[model samples]
Target: MKKAFVAFILLIFISTSRAAKVTDWLDSYNVLWTSQSKGSYDSMPCGGGDIGLNVWVENNELLFYISRSGSLDENNCLLKSGRIRVKLTPNPFINSGFSQQLNLRKGFVDVNAGNTNIRLWVNVFSPVIHVDINSKEKLSAEVYYENWRYKDRPVRKGEGNANSYKWAIPKGLVTKADVIENSTDKVIFYHKNDAQTVFDVTVAQQGMDSVKSKMYNPIGNLTSGGMLFGDNLKFAGTSSGEYAGTDYKSWCMKSVKPSSSHHVLIALHTQQTESLNQWKQGLADIVKGIKSNDDKKRTQAWWNSFWNKSAIRINEKNKDSEAWKIGRNYQLFRYMLGCNAYGSYPTKFNGGLFTFDPARVDSTLNFTPDFRKWGGGTMTAQNQRLVYFPMLKSGDFDMMTSQFDFYLRILKNAELRSKVYWNHEGGCFTEQIENFGLPNPSEYGWKRPANFDKGLEYNAWLEYQWDTVLEFCNMILETKEYNNEKIDKYVPLIESVLTFFDEHYRMLATQRGRKVLDGDGHLVLYPGSACETYKMAYNSTSTISALTVVLEKMIEYSAADSTKSARWKQMLSTIPPITIREENGKKMIAPAKLWERINNIESPQLYPVFPWRVYGVGKKDLDVAVNTYFSDSDALKFRSHIGWKQDNIFAACLGLTKEAQRLTSLKMKDSELRFPTFWGPGYDWTPDHNWGGSGMIGLQEMLMQTNGEQILLFPAWPAEWNVHFKMHAPKNTTVEAELKDGKVTSLQVYPAERMKDVVIMIKK
Candidate 1:
């Protein structure tokens, strides 16, 4: 009762916080995404870094602010405000116990742990930040004023308190960003990593040096006394030791507002010890580029076009309702993910979306500067796929293509590293390969709690490198056309992956006591089952299921008469059947061990339901399979979203639309801890950093569904919707669903090709 009451209070708080009208909330700024926001084919860092934004209209005066957070300010006007000032200041990291003030009057907050603070101070004046690395070395700073917008703007209409500007931040800089948005005066500061750095910002007022200093906890938690971090400490201001007297650069840019032609000034300064002239040239060129660009118009146009691609009919008849709220919110949420997809950092592995929070990190990370609470890294297959689910369904094919290019490139590196780690073997992929496939210093050949290399011969050995290609291959395969060169490249890579597994397989007659050489190996294990545990006493259901699918897929692609393809077909024949077991009156799918111990994560048995197709209501063993799923028991139900989790997926297929609706309502717990976003507390409740995207899938499943082969229209939406939904399928097919009177009135499909068993449900 106490838990439920607290949860209820939290829910009320969240609802109240999120209840502002869209117009009143989002009327301030507009966001757009494009090549700039998307980054380039061979862009620096090969990913899109996020941008920062500040724009407001107060007392008939426009208070506009932006930073080069993400190419948002391609124009460096802000970098060249009136009478630009330059100075050489000591860097912060070298010193200890010295507190530096880049911005002040916003007050200070401190973390209870290590006195670190995650500060959020906006005193109705400005969102300012101070970056004080260490108080020892002097650095240079530059301020840009009245700058043009970047080609990519991130604000959008109907957004409430969402960011309007995105500042592009390049990789490999040593500094901190701080803000104090409210006070008699607002302050923004850039604290440097070393003896030299640059401060690039835009401000309106100039020639005024009324600055305030503040000393807050480094971590800046809102509550608690300051505790200096062990290895990551924030230094002090009165303890400054050295200040440079070397080189400096300055520039000023002033521009008239586009709408009112109100005058605005931009200033920029740079300080460097070595080769300052090059810094000047680079700064100057970038500023010149910023000055010459037409950012506002470009960003607006790009965003306009993006939203026009599809429209949401929340109430279809009425765009406002509880259903509409969830639907439109979901619509906009998809757009946000689209903008951030691999935009920067190839998407986090643990927590893919809703603010990069990793599940766990290594202890040595303390010696590193990044906060432990900032979350963990180390990408895995389960999380990666979840992030992209909405992408594939939402007509963001461009993102899908970019993702493919990104992952394929990464896979090349992973393959090379796997060769080295697994003795140059063709099979066996490691647990966490680096972005470029080289292992990070901390994780390569790391020890595990489960006493096995996460790179062990698990299903991922075939799934990660190969299964990732299946959807793309399926799309291309459906075409039945010829892109011989592309085919040759992808096919060979795919073939090589298959060859590794085929050779790695150990032909044992008994697998977990099954008749044939079943689930005992990594990719083709006889005893080992889904996710390497929850095994059946006899057979490995997930292994054989995956192999059956993978092998069958490879054979299908190998041309009708290909020799190797013939062997793949033969291999499938030898695959064993899954063993069935009953436990306490419930049918379950465990062919090996009931609950064998392993260091695996996520529910792999559901593979037969999702990603890989082997079981579901449509399959032969539907009852037994579902029984396996339901019977698994909820020992850890919260993490799994157990009953309610699978309910959403199964409801649509079983035509139990009402149950699906109820489950979605239960799943979404709006609160500060939970971003009005769909991720949840994993029984442990810390937030399932990896499951944010899965909620979006349930949303689409509720609206439209596709069973590996065909598409479904309004397969699971509530009768109250009374609406129309238009969505794009794998091969560029446009599906439209028009619902009225609580049933589908008409289902239209403009399929690019022949459609599969597309299920279009109507009022019965």
Candidate 2:
């Protein structure tokens, strides 16, 4: 009893030593957004739609609201088909020592800006733009939701989907502007460019649609008016006429909550000024709805509660080391990933959360941040797998399931399509594809490539991706889930995946008569040019790692089913061995090394190290991988995406941690708003790019080792972190451990650690 209590106190001491909090000093409504300030550029957009939003942080003792500003146009729009959403995430920061208690709160939205900064509260449902502006001075507020249509009212249009065709802000609607405080009613006019008192009456208004119906297109649907889809709710509009000899515009709103489930047209707008009127009014409305302190308080409490669930104790002395930073970054990555994950499509590693279509690129109006799929760049299979990484441990699994289900359908559909197109020979699923199962137009052009018609991404089979899905499928199944047929169905799919690899390769003699996959030198020849060289040469690392994992899992599963044992074992041997060749003193794992110029996309080498199980050789070859990772020739290395260019940050962190060099991982840490919401290469580092790598923090196989089936607690914890640490392993759970002055102090496991014959080692 004494020992256990002593351990608990020591754990508390250790946890407090490295624990830190997120410093949220600003609200989304405080950053005065207007036309002159280009607030639209800072907002989330609808893919291929032309609308934007500028989030301003408005907060005080009265209320806290995210003042949204901007409009629909050729660039950014609130396309009706897109879901209007607001979300919050918490419990993200990981400490080096032990777990810390935290609380989290629910987040609310004040769609309009002119509200009391602190006293405001929002209901469950919000119209696209409701809660209007009624005052121009301190303590005044508004209640409204608004949207505008095309400027030159399309002559061909009948009442589109909206009640008013004249939704655009005509000159007469520009009355009753910004609100002020502590003064007689003074007109707070829009600032032409903040710091002045003027406005742009000519500035256009926004158009809202419940669906994305383009009027002109050769490939997509050519519907003009719009669809009656969205969070199909009700709405109200006010008279746009002279009032008190000035001007007046009103917006009436109804519950936007979906009756069934569809879309709706909503107009959002902001006045051209910043007095306290809008803030006060917004706050007053929120106050009326409030039953608690404020949104901030609630949000903070929510986040705090979440953090308390799991604490990441950090070794402060190891700060600035890449290993330490990677661990920290993993936490940050999950935190960033946790925020704003709402939409039919998926999150983007590209610029916009919904920032689809880069307005103009390569002299053409191209949509980059797309809605029908996870846009930015292609390869949803890899990135999608990564995006869901946070779910296995710390998240509501619904979104994760949605994303996985969508992709699983895509994979199955591709297979079915391949059976028809390739006559069941098996070979489809592109290296990159849209979330909607459409091949990328830029890479393959408007027509689906004849090779791709069979469903394979690269003409060559991406055997790795197939295995990755199977792994995920099994992960879901093994959790003792009730509805596990979803996993069972995928098992057969994986079996087929192995069959394809079995049939595709032709064995040939290489060094010492070892069997080698002959890209038939096709990669070096003509038709092979299409396959990425880096992926074409040697036995691809991704492939071999995947094959190994697949084979191992299949062998385990078949062990219980005698009928399939022989067949599974026979095929397992056929899976190729990873090719590790020496190049200039560094170890190089190749896809087969047959092509001339390896495309930058070939980064499967690290599969064995991470996402795959490969090697931790004691030689200098690790240097080769690291050097080549940062090698001058690596195209992605110089990309502006700060950190993610090199895929090895996590691996490197792991490697360093494994080597007990906590100093290296500490240096590469990145942060968002100084709270450790980290990720450097924003575009290149997406779901897995950012969050996938973040998984390193939770499953720290490097520091807290996991070999075979046992757990190795603190295999690489730095001396400073000896003060505190908390972690858990599968089966019989949680472990609270601590150290002081480079020596072990105490260790405790909750619910007891022995689940099976699983070994638990306290390594020296």
Candidate 3:
């Protein structure tokens, strides 16, 4: 009773504090769609834990697409749990003052129309969706299941880009097999993969067919299904057929008990087991577990803590201004990230878990909910890193584990592939990695060039792009710094990843016709690429910088182990220096020492400024870093505060107050969509995770910067901007501050001992 009372009081205190911190901002910025949506394109996103729902009212009925993280199909593709449609007999939503709002504070959607108030919320702890409808008078409700893959569908061209270069590749790619379903109102549908799923296809494509017996196949035989169950409802009818060039299957369940209120719930489950009864039992357990209100309270508690982790609020300079938009969108985007707090896999960079129909996104695409621009199983390291980097400053450490576990799960396979091919003791990760740690089969280049190296990927952009893994390595180390995380679990991964470059490059140096060692007798990185740009380059700055920074940290962390520390120090010494060249009379960080031509658009030069943090706001050589930011032609040409853009990051790191604010304002502004947070497919799909993540990182960096015992406040903030922020830093430190009208009203640094590190940047 005492514990319960304490929890309740803590909840109340948090509630009150949250109200003071963000209620005004959320009220002014919550997404409010006044009219019915045209289609799924304009759906409102809502989710908790791993479950995601895209809710929208269409044609006098409410519809939503249900999806869950880590629910991959046979082809290693992320699958959706079908769509749900609810309609009332009285039709309260037809031309009757419709309003759909995503309540930011409560983390639920409230749809009000006519005399009905419909509340839609998903339980974070349990995989259950809740719908409660209340009306002035008793009314009947009909819930429908819309399944698109009822029958065996052929893998058609342009259906999805998952197969990758279908026109060029002649390999036969089969679509999903027939879905298992029943004709009853208590509808349950599942997709089961046989032994001959895409897992076999990818293994063959990557030339790992010989080692197929040794590979870990998560999709060899997997079952993922959803069940609809609710009291006060009975079987109404069923429909199975095609409509308007689309095939689908559905079952209708109608309210049996006549009451003023109606409650309906759906529980979803997935498993590696193939037994149908076991899968059914899993769903049954979910329903049973969610019946009690315990999970709901726990869910609320989880979200309550998530909202209180770290936050930022901007004083509204003017209506719809950039500053106001940045602040509001930061919270909105963070809400989206929080929805999948317990995802099995990391939230994807393209669409994360909130993707609607492809046909809805673009009529030309006309694909299923499972379809995304990149392959479903493919986790592009370049884009994927951006999605997780911001979690450090935001103090979303638990969320970072999903990504860490993803790499850890596949680490053994990565190391095995390297050993099998090169007889090495390291893990080789390409740009496009399958969920199970192999190059994406489709993008591995169907047509092999003459004498092409089998070990290296055939795709030009991904060739020799193993250094991207280091960013995640850095994230792991940084997590330890901020939280005192157990380094034992992640040390192997970091060691093996770094070992690949160390041993592989040295071996390659000996094979080259000419001596490939620099003046210091260090191995020269040749035949490398600078982030899909500067192909066939030597000494790529990004790769070198990654090796140098990660090696130093590894040595520092492993000081107790003399042998490991010595090896790390030696490797660090062997890394070539980051190149600097005079461009138009200004010295700037060069992408590489030598290269043939540009292949892709990415400013790897600024990597030293942000992720590596070799130079930053309070670091040495600030002018050179600042000059690189302004003078780099590639960065200037490709710069935009859109999807995957890092302009805010660079500006903030350089302490460019005005530029940081400007870029971040643009980065966080409402995207041209009904949902403000659905930023773009700007080189990626809708609701870009990288765009939101970069914006979050920029906002946090603008407020505070931590560099080696020094914590600087308002490092890159505009003098006129008034703000309130609390963010995590290294050494288990958190800095909370409020800046109002160019004056520091309050400041608090946790652990009081660390207060000496705080340096308030006051503008006069």
Candidate 4:
């Protein structure tokens, strides 16, 4: 018994020692700089709890652009809350001893110079921004609330891209000014939405005006912004200036007296209310709820828990290696995702909440800091799916709620589209959908043929692309698979989405002929699309795979009662089999059985190997999927590591080590920006989130994959690249493993019974 006790104590020490090494490895990835930034483009990201700030020190002044999730303006643009500037009287920032560090472990920014230091952080549980300053000598601080929307500004020809208007802005469209109130020690500001927002225009444009009153409008009476106040500070009047080619006004607050230490707080609030006073009360409530004594500790604890959930560190002994960089970037991008863990809306794939000025991204487009190519409030499921899919393996299930809730909130609106248009059942979600669950007006077509279907988008790229929402539905179900979490709230959404495909396709078939099913007793599935790539397709492979997998999982998980399960099984039987054909003497999956034309560069043929998981490392007929990856003309032509590209993912899923390594390295390489992971403007905006997300998925897939109850380890990972990783799998399980010199040094599988399911593919 004594010997057993001694061994147990030794085991505890070894476990603690391994944990410390992991923590130290994570610390090495924290960003650090010894000099001031040139502009916002070179800033570091810092925030939490749905708020993101582009933080930087420039010209001896501390400046940060504040952005919060769901800050939609009258034009349906996701606007920045505002910019805040801080200046200290005896400014230490100008001193030679200057440094700025983003401590990822604590989720805060630390700026130091001479004898003064400043720390910036956002409360993870509250909508509040905090800046704490410490100094050896007494110093006065001046805080400014800057707003470029001080007066109504007309959006230029190209600037309308930031809003829902895209390139089809209505005449005389203008971004209204914000309201600012200055007081003795505080400055409060807000932008209340105009009564007539894009929701009203979109309803009329989509021929839904008759039922507009019943549709959900997220922008109506929406008030967003907050109060900036500090200890021992007094209002110092206002000033006007120009920033990034736009005019702005500032409300200044200066310290009443010099002090050795000071604190500043900016409390933000956003709500759709009938009265402005009610919104103000909400903001006041946030301030009153600020538990100063323990908020910081609690926020720090949250970040700590976040880091401990899941991690991947590669080549820990060599930080500069490309292998190490891939792992570092994976964590960095995950940090950005963590910033909006509790957001009301999902993170945007274009830039999320960290976009800077447009000029910085494209020198020709000199627009405001809020400028992003894609329309704000528009959810592109094709790109947005990439952003949230990686969270499952990383065990960030809580963050997935925002994206799931987004669909739930608008389920009624989406169902309304089907009822009003085709007089049928099921939710009809379009590819480019607005916040209120309707096709984007611009994509719906400003000038359309008189008889064109009002229900379908007229644009070639987005028309008949209703299948992308299936990816999200599958993600919602996977949350239960990975964490065994209750998904009662999402069951109705899943049923509605599946019902749409079944009923709508049947309705279309009945319109074309007498029978709803084809000669083979299956849905015809004509006029369908294979992602935006194969248009006017017959029996699209992507659509079939999505429907088949989701239905099978639904029945397997018993997400529904006996009656619903019976219907799902019947529908599953009707889904057409994924089509495969011989290309150059090699059997390969076809994009579809037939297609009229190709519209984009996406490769949907291999999608079944991925998202749908019909064929993969351990699945049947893997050779056919591998043949498509290598032999298909469109697949080869479209292979790339650019934004939203999934070649790396396909290669990983197929267990192609060399191919996966080459593609994923390119995807995860350091970007041109100072921040290593701020990848792109590839096909969207700078700090391309989907780009990072796809990279994360590729890396995670290379390391681990699951087939039913089996866990495949090092499926496609390079043996030479040492790694320590912890990833979540189905059945509420987690696998943590360490590999060094092409050998497994240690392995731990939660719930010891799962050890039998682990397959070590890497040979020693």
**Of the candidates shown, which would achieve the greatest TM-score relative to the real structure?**
4
lDDT against the true structure, per candidate, is 0.35, 0.34, 0.79, 0.90
Residue-wise C-alpha lDDT for candidate 2, range 554-641, written one tens digit per residue: 7776788876777778766665565555656666555333434455453555555545544432223555444434332432343222
Question: Which sections of candidate 4 miss by over 4 Å?
Answer: 1-24
Q: CA lDDT of 737 in candidate 3?
A: 69
- Tell me the tens digit of each residue's lDDT in model 3 across 1-764: 01111111211212112223434344665778888888777889899988889999888889898988877776676878888889897888876888999887667899999899998888987788888889997888998878887766666676546543333433455557546454444767777777676667667766677777777777666777777756777777778765324678888888886667888888888787768788778887887777536766777677767877777878865655677777778888888888888888889898988887776566787666767777677788888888888888888998888888888888888888888778878998888888888887656776787677767788767788888888999999989999988868989999999999877887788787566466787878987878887788899988988899899999999899999999999888889899988977888888899998888887888888878888897688878888889988888897888788888999988888888888888888888878888888778788788888888888888888877888877778886888877788889887666777776666666766776777766444
Error of 1 at 754 (Å): 5.2
Question: What lDDT would candidate 3 get against the real structure?
Answer: 0.79
TM-score of 1: 0.57
Better of 1 and 4 by lDDT: 4
Question: Please, what are the lDDT tens digits per residue for candidate 4 over residues 207-227?
Answer: 998888898999989999999
Inter-residue clash pairs, candidate 4:
none
Off by over 4 Å in 3: 1-29, 163-172, 177-180, 183-185, 240-245, 316-319, 513-517, 762-764
lDDT of 1: 0.35
lDDT score, residue 640, model 4? Answer: 97
